[model samples]
Target: MTFKGVHRLLLLVFMGLALAGCQTEDTPAKPQFVSTTSDSRNSNYFIEFRSRYALSYGHTYVVFGRTDGSGQMINPEVAGLHPKSTSAVPYVIGHFVPVPAETGWSDGDLEEPYRSASWRVMLSQAEYNKVVRKIRDLQANSKFWQAALYNCNAFTGDVARSMGYSVPPIQLRPQEFVTKLREMNEGRRSVSPSRVLTAS
Candidate 1:
């Protein structure tokens, strides 16, 4: 053919490719907020954070479900420790509470003197495992818990990072840390605001 005939053929092909691209763009991607299950359907885990008022500086902790959806709470064990326990050679430990579902306390009823908020994590099963293992391993190490330094807030932050989540690096009080986490998770498919059960 001639030059004009060649030009017309090229234009038609370009228009066809553009239309195909537009069609592909019209299709929506699947939502990532839903929980991912393993081959045996064993992923009933949910990562959660709990924040409550404290006389000193407020408190924050991480909660998660067992493979069966049972609740477990982990926090630095410093409240009842004797002053001598944190003396010259300060020592701190962790408290792991595996709550029974039958108890109404699972919702975090702190009564008067305290208020709380929670957030549920929406991530894949594999990611959930990473988060859980991180917390559990830390819980097992008595050296990892420090009443002043590697406190519960730090613990939560570590777990969040292990799960591929991010929070501000600034030094934050417990409640502030919890608030920051919620803010960071806003609109993210990997996390969601959870029910807040307040007693006072």
Candidate 2:
């Protein structure tokens, strides 16, 4: 095959890999710690999108932090969206329309065995701050969650877009969402934020 043929074939491969995993979207235990803030070095800011198995479909979330000199993530913060109450009422209603949502760490966020996929990226201080700001805004203003609309994948996509990362379609499972994100941005090692963040 020619070079052009190879390129096109690779693109098709990735597209199929992503679409093949699509089907749906979990809940995890209460988190003991939150926020990527501590006596950590901000010289290197990083954000990681992760997925974990929960119930039938899995869950997606972001864990961001600074690394120590040894490159260990410190004070990792977790954020995501899910129904506010653990009861089946809100979650079931969320499938048809928006319902009360909670934007923070859920169960299995810190568990390795539960994680099915992860995509981590290093960001400039500017990009990191911008992403964090957007995360906060979404967390504060995102009062609803719906399986077909404002679910966990939607939440992570917002954060990714803030960092100028092209977001994949949202109607996918958590692991697929993260995988597609990494596949789509395989060339973007260091990217600028969508726009300069202004204080709000």
Candidate 3:
């Protein structure tokens, strides 16, 4: 072959290799969970379980059947399921402030102070186990759950989508999902919000 033709061929080969490298770099990396020592983290493998659990309420229900029998003194359903046992009680206390004792109450009566906004039901041991198993399964296979996110619920939906399940129509679009998630994360939205507010 002519020298010029040989040079052109070499240049094309180099260009092809460069393009291939670019394509590889452009592809998204696999998702991973954040490391955490909290019991709540253990419950969901520390991968933004609160949002993931909330988003997958159906799964949550299946895992943690509606009952409180763990004797942990805090209910997962009302307090929010945590991977770590210690974290679970505190989480409930923080979110749902316990009602103070009556003015005449003695020191002994302090143990069972009422919760101002206690959850209606706590998850039984069987239910808690179910939740743990489901979370493990999601961690093992749910890609959306793995992705890093400023908003964890969005990540949960993304994982659901990755699993080939259609996300809720309300969460089909990213913007909508993010908006709803933000409200939930901020504690503005609830299962029963006093007033529904639309995103601007």
lDDT of 2 at 114: 90
Candidate 2's residue-wise lDDT over 56-76, tens digit each?
A: 477889998786777578899
Model 1 agreement with the true structure over 51-100: per-residue lDDT tens digits? 55543444566655543344233331211111123232432122211111
Better of 1 and 2 by TM-score: 2
lDDT of each: 0.44, 0.71, 0.27
Q: For candidate 2, which ten residues in a row score worst on lDDT?
A: 31-40
Q: Which stretches in model 1 have alpha-carbon errors above 4 Å?
A: 1-44, 66-115, 142-148, 189-200
What lDDT score goes with residue 105 in model 1? 28
Question: Could you give candidate 3's per-residue lDDT for residues 21-123 as a string of tens digits?
Answer: 1231111211211221212222321112222111111111111222223324222221121222223343233222222111111111112221111111122
> How far does residue 123 in candidate 3 sit from its true spot (Å)?
0.4
Lowest lDDT 10-mer window, candidate 1?
95-104
> What are the TM-scores, per candidate, against the unseen true structure?
0.48, 0.73, 0.22
Better of 1 and 3 by lDDT: 1
